[model samples]
Target: MTTALPSGLASAGLNAGEQELLDRVGQVARACAERADHYDRTARFPADDFDDLFAAGLNAPTVPREHGGLGLGPLSRDTLTLWLVTKELAKADLSLGRCWEGHANALVLVDALGSAEQKRRWFDGVVTRGEKWVGWSGEPQAPKPGEKRRFGTSVVRDDGAWVVTGTKVFATSATGAQWAILLVDTEGPGGARHAPDGRDSLLMLACDLSDPSVSVDDSWWDPIGMRATVSHLVRFDGTRLPDANVIGAPGAYLREGWQTAFIPHYAASFLGAAEAAYEYALKYVIRQDKVADPYVQHRVGSMAVDVESAYLWLRHVATLWDTGKREEARLAGSRARHVVEHLALRTVDNCVRVCGARSLIRPSPVERILRDLTFYVRHDNDDQVLATIGRALLGQEHDASFYKP
Candidate 1:
């Protein structure tokens, strides 16, 4: 079930080894595609998909180049390769792609800002032990009325360790993750202490999820789609983490700019799901002998345009990152995310319309893909993203090359 990527989508500067790696992932995608529905129905973690990825040597994309890893390029240095890998995984299963993306994102943070020992330990866990990682940054606001909305999670120093208390929601891949990268306020028991350097109080800590005080509440994650992601609520009840577990300095997570580079990873997943929907629609039409009908032809043709547009946006964003256009890449990525969001939604909607009601039935590939795309694309507010783009243009001048076509 491996589909050939359209000719225009080919990447440049890939070594023979990288190309072979991609080919191996194609086989893994097939295995994941076969098991996607069962996992979705049971709302279980796609452990098999991850096993396949690990066995194929894809579990650690940021291991230092000297250690035989893909390096930080997956985040910024090597975005095109990361884009292709993520898109391919998502083409088979968006939930799996999402979880893997989080794993890789955490690794990039370590690579960029972690101490040498931290990098050695975390990267070894992933590349050697086959450990899985997850990120949990969002927390539900405190429920007390008249309280300002803010992060409820906080960590404090205690006996040479950091004790964490509070709950994190949307803990993607929480079911079986061996490690977690948590965002917490460094304010101590006094309640509101700021960083000594006057930076943001928000800090990231890498902790073992096996800590006895840590627990995952799986009941809260029954959602409209992406059910297999198992992004449940995680609570840390005075969870003790070693002082050595602290990652980077306070605010380093945001200061490093990897977050902007990670935006296109989401865009890649969205485009992949849309591409899957498009493929299903094509097969449906061919099977029904309706490929010659004018209505079907028009719908397919329009979907082609949207898919192609998404491809171009991804390429531009990846190119911007590759060329070290950091500021331009940030802005382009912001706009590209929204652009791909709309294009993906339209592509799926049109696929469903063209395929008719039968495609909505169980076991139809389009059925699950439509649900996954619809749920996952709502990760951000389109209005807020657009406003950020507008404000950037209003406040600054840009070179003409930044906005060409």
Candidate 2:
């Protein structure tokens, strides 16, 4: 059954390359949605979906031709292309959307940070024959010296190489990935505002997961939603990295400016989830005889407005990002992602309310959405962000200017 989107999408033209990529991505999405139920039911990983994704070079969107990509292809900056594409994929299957999100993060790291030589070597591996999926593994201490591992694990230099120790939890697909873009503390000694660990830290290192030091534990994620993510614990017991594997500058990963660009790529994942709910809910509610009642129509009507409002907000965020409004982008990026992620849950809640018990039935797409959206809605810093945004608006110390470049 064809799923109707919650509202109308404006007619827009995609130049040749843009349209082509979107068209091809759509086919993959169709296949993924087709298999979402079975995968969710058995808790099976979406291995086949990824195989197809790699074939399409979706894993390395920004890798240049020299390193094996479509070579800095044009993704429409105005529209929510990533969101739209991801939503389609999520509508078909959220697991695959998730798997690709991690891959996309690695690709962004490689494209933006990898050294020329690193690009030549690793990006080639990804493009020529599709390299293994990459994971993150750096967890520097929170500045106050009391916080446990937060980001990447540890960065210890050994024999002109880096030996990293620490595990990065919430690794989405560790069991299947071949490589990982790790975060490490290269500045072994120093202190700064964000560098509370006295480790002038943060390095994006490429790691070969085969090293004996790295171990992938059994999948332990039993969540209220998104049950098939295969998200599990990864322990790096002093995993070592070659000097050449360092992808970016020593301190670039967590730098203030980095969030502006890097976070949007992930934001699309939530937008996709929200869009998927919007897309699927339309078809779902319409087919249900129960929702035809007046009170139910009121609920569905609100969902439609929320979905459209959310999309416009997303596009505005993307526009700010493309136009180099970095500070605004950062704030909007946070807000956009927050709205997208939360709206997704709201949309799903509407689905459950409108569709009733059918949404709870096993193997149903609505149930899968409940799982996926719930996971995204749990992202950190909502109250703090809102307080900061409010303070800035009130001409207090933490104004928008505080985030402005």
Candidate 3:
């Protein structure tokens, strides 16, 4: 039997086409949830979930319609509907949500920075073939105290072709992605360093994962949560590409406001995970005849508030972006993500607290939800996000924005 969303979720400002898409995504979410536990237990990639997505014609919603996509790309003005779709998908499986969001991020980069020819090539592959792409930016190492972080990957001009050599850690969907939109330092060996301002060194390149020089290292990615994401480390050893492969010039990746736009997507997905945990707790309480307890009732009420507040914050930020108030949108997105992160964490904890020990055991959906949501919310730079919001409200502009430029 199919489950229905809350009364207003599909009707809230969505056009008929969008509403239909949301209904279809609901079915996809159910399928994903059914298999989520099995994937988590075995620490295997959720290949079946993606296959289901492809069959549903839900693989490339962000691609342009002319290119066979729904054209709801990240840069599109329709932000609220997209968030709703992301939230539903995440509720079923946070791992797949993370992977799907990465694909959206890649599309945003391509739309903003890719050459026309590059877009035609990659976008057609995505819409026509259900090909998957992922974004890769995490480095394996960090700078020491009092030192700025530098890129570990490098792209250099060699014999009229670009030679890319570097390792990217936490590369989501590496095991299954056909392509990667990677961030690399354009400065070659013995070349000048990136500007201290942190804006001029990075270049975005499209790398074909099927290349002979690309390798996936699955040894380091066994995490406590979101294991089915297969976020393995990827190594590029002198991977060669033509000049046409460069998505954008050095510094173009950060300049397009993609990072700021991505905040809501993460928040929405984590919120969905929190919702899943809360719903499971609700069912368990009623099934066990504990719903009459005042304390249990209070806890559930509080969880409801958290989930609703997250949804509202996400909507506000999406609206702000859709209206083209980009700076305000960025500030709001950071603040909303911060608020939702805390709320999501609290909601999951409340779920466990209300259910007692059974919620912590294997085969219990709450336990898996807790682990996945916990790991997912640990995105870096929380303190910085807070400070950025604080500064914005105080009418003080920091030399740099909270996001990397």
Candidate 4:
């Protein structure tokens, strides 16, 4: 028998079209889960899984209908549906879900900030052609030994074209992505070498990853879990693009609050990973005839509670976004992220504890799930997120400003 969705998610607020999309996502997720082990074992990119997603019309749901997409507009009830889709996918395969989230984030930005021509180009390449898209924004390298550390990749205007030069670590799904929306600084050769306000000059560049100037370094991505994601280091050396390739104005990427709008997606993905571990433990315990033990029951009960709480928190964050409670939604997103992160970690731990040492061996789904969940929840700015929440709660600063990128 097919498992029933949680009560909270069974009746989640979704329109007819959104429900249809969720069903499609669920189908693809199940298929992805069936092959997740092989992909993990080989540490290879799940290209076939993405092909299944694309064939199911699940590649670019956030693009507007006018641009040939599912037209799930920003900050709408559809956002909740999208979160459900990501959660289901993550439950099946966290690495694929990570790549999907990046794709969704890219579409969100394109829909919000792209000009008419830019949107048409992106829609044709991604939505129509079924090409995969990813986002690369994280950077921790400096251009020179003495220069102040650069905050992001750099782009310089050169002879009517833009030359992007920098290296980005953790370029999730970089190996498979056909296009990337890169965060760049345009203030100077390498973005205001020592300026105090250089961070505010961030810009978004939509680059074709097939360009010769782009190179992928896969040597740095040997992780404990989510190994299939292939989030390697990527270098852009004199990667030239026309001025039209720039997606938004300088600082537009941050000013639009896109990051805050999509925070629930991340929470949903992590929650799904935890749920996967919990379900694995449930099945293992039942098969081993240990479900009747009081200790086993207690652990299972706690896992269920944690999973449900995380789902509810994700729903709350989605509701806040839908209701136009922008500031409150931002603050709530941060709080929910922290809560879900803790709950997910605990849920995985409980699952491992209940299942015992045998579950930690090879060919055991629980072991892999635990590793994936542990690595996935280590998102940046954990302590800073809590500090921001504290500041907002104490009225020391405006809540919305705390989530500015």
Candidate 5:
């Protein structure tokens, strides 16, 4: 029997064409799930899965309608559809969902902050040429105390072109991607700001990864879970980019809302993996004729509750975003992810207990899903997020923003 999503997750206000598109995504997701184990075992890029996504036009769903794309909005009812899409992909393969989310995020950032020409170029690259892209925001912290944290990758102007240098850690899906939306520090050795008043010095650039100066170091990415993401360390040494590659003014990337908006995607991913584990455990119990056992039913009941809670959190997030309560949405997303993180851990543990030792062995979908989720849920600093939410409750100074760009 085919595994179905938990009750009430079937639709998200999608029209006929959009619903058809979602069905296509479901087909692609199942295909990816079939190969997810191979990619994770080898720690390699799932090129076949990405090829399927690109061929199905899933790569540019958020690009504006005028740009010849699906035109899903970031803060509309479409947000629900995006959540469902991410959850469906993640249910099949967490790593694939991560990379695809990054690709979709890059497109959203480019459309939101890129110039008209930049939008035309980047959106066309995805919609027409089927070029894969990744967004890199990870940066090394400042080495010394009392130093303000900034993007370690520094870009400087030389003879009307921009030269970029620095390393980005955990650059997921960098292997197959041809383009990157990078957040870099513009104040190079000369300490010059792109704008007056010394504000907004952080620059966001659309870079071509095919540049000889850009190198991807795969040696650093051996992790316990989410291995199929291929999130290797990417280094850019003296890479030159054109003036047109600059996205909006310095710091526009952060000011634009993608940072806060992306939290629910993480929640959706964790929730999906947890739900998958639940389904696996449920089926295992049935197959073993253990459904009549009270202990098995108790564990199943516990997992069911957690899964239902996660779904409600995700739906609330979508509703908040649709109503233009962005700040509330961000906070809700943080709380949702924090709670879902623990819920996933608990659900997966219950699955292991229910399925017994045999399911832990290789080639079992449950085993791979367990490992993938074990690592994927450690995203964003949970402690800090909780403290921030606490501060908000106390009416103290707190920032709802997850990323500072």
Candidate 6:
């Protein structure tokens, strides 16, 4: 609604073709919102939604045409395009928007780090063939007591092949996907997996979900929000992956390259969620004509300010993507995520107060938006990001490492 739209966000990073493709994606997602709950209620995958995205050729923007995609090169190409697209889809339905996050991560991996054969072999599957998968963030085996510090899966080299045995608890899209980019234990006797000191390692594996070595047992996914996301346990027995499936050798998984490269792709979903809350609140209050009252106007104005701030912060972060600052992106990612999501909840809560219990009704548009925003605001992973920023301000590497990329 504001001409203040981050200027050139579309043209600078995308071609005319890509812009057209993004428009088509937005249209299709708008149409599919009606059916999102049908799948959500049944705990079924949103196949028709995926079909719509695939038909629109919007599976992953980062994959190259040589591999059968738009070749947009991650969030860097058209940051606003990626931001708007993900937010619009999420407004329609979070589960569908969320599944795309995994696909985007995989695409970034294939484009940024995949070997030539990987591009040759699985590139088309991602773009042209519509191969979809989820990243393994929360999935972990039962870490012995407090061993949650380690990602439970293990990838041990056996002769020329790799054998993987572990369980991914609460793995999203557990039975529906053909591949998973799982984290694994690659620390050797030295325990130096990352710079400075850390015993943990990250491993990204392209595994066969169809093999008997993989079993999806006990779908323990009763949640107050993000329902219909059938996040369950996926167990990997003594399964063998061709050594080629290992990404970036044995020890490079947790470094700045792999982690930072694909991290922001998941964040589009969070930004989208927060935006949904803001948009839903704004529309509800205006439609109800609640703004006529002086108190209501003041409250509505506050919410508008919050909405503007969230998008403004988002576009600022988008600017970072425009500049291609990959190595120093960690703290920026954390701060942007926290700020946008915070504004989302604050905006939604204000709107809910303005709308009263009507906002809390079953399937109330604002109610669902509020729930989604709450969950979005809570996705804090490693607590080191804020700590790192604080340390950098004090010029103390002993406290943390900071990147300026």
lDDT by residue (tens digit), candidate 5, 1-405:
333446445564557876887798899999998998899888988889888888887867678878877776473347777777888888888898888788877787787777888888788888888888877876645444764434357777898888988777678888978998877767542111122233467677788999899999888678998888898878889999888888888766545545667777788888878888898898888889888788887888889888878887888888888888877887888898889888888898999988899989877788888888878876677787788789878998665555221
Off by over 4 Å in 1: 1-8, 12-15, 72-76, 142-151, 187-199, 396-405
| Ten residues in sequence with the least summed lDDT for candidate 3 | 188-197
Top model number, TM-score: 3
- Model 3, position 363: C-alpha lDDT score: 79
Candidates 2 and 3: which is better by TM-score?
Answer: 3
Task: Give the whole-model CA lDDT for all candidates, comma-separated.
Answer: 0.78, 0.62, 0.79, 0.77, 0.78, 0.61
On a 0 to 100 scale, what is the lDDT of residue 209 in model 5?
Answer: 92
Residue runs of model 5 more than 4 Å from their true location after superposition:
1-6, 12-15, 73-77, 142-151, 187-199, 403-405
Which model scores highest in lDDT?
Answer: 3
After TM-score superposition, what is the CA distance of residue 96 in candidate 3 from its true location, in Å? Answer: 0.8
Q: Write the residue-wise lDDT of candidate 1 on 1-405 in tens digits.
A: 323345646455677876777788888999999999998999888998888778888878766776556664544467777777888889999998898888877787777778998888788888877888876776654444764534356787899988888777778998868998887777532111122223457677898988899898887788988988999878889988886888888766554545676777789899889888888888888888888799888988888888888888988887888887888888889788989999999999889989999888988878888889889977766776777677677885321111211
- Indicate whether candidate 1 or candidate 4 has the larger lDDT: 1
lDDT of 3 by residue, 1-405 (tens): 112235564347778998999899899999999999998887777888878888988888677777777777347787787778788888998988898888877887788788889889999888878889988877635454774534367777888788888777778998888999877767542111222234667667788999999998888788999998888878889999777888877776555556777877899898889889888888888889898799998988888888888888987888888888888887788888889999999999999989999889977888888889889887546777787677767877542233322
Give lDDT: candidate 5, residue 166: 77
Q: Find the 10 residues in a row with the least total lDDT in model 4.
A: 189-198
Worst 10-residue lDDT window, candidate 6: 188-197
- Shift of residue 316 alpha carbon in model 6, Å: 2.4
Residue 285 lDDT, candidate 1, scale 0-100? 86
Reference-based TM-score, model 1: 0.90
Q: Provide the lDDT at 269 for model 2.
A: 65
- Clash pairs detected, candidate 6: 328-405
Candidate 2 clashes: the total is 13
- Of the pair 1 and 2, which is ahead by lDDT? 1
Clashing pairs in model 3?
Answer: none
Q: List the candidate 3 regions with Cα displacement exceeding 4 Å.
A: 1-6, 9-11, 143-151, 188-198, 395-405
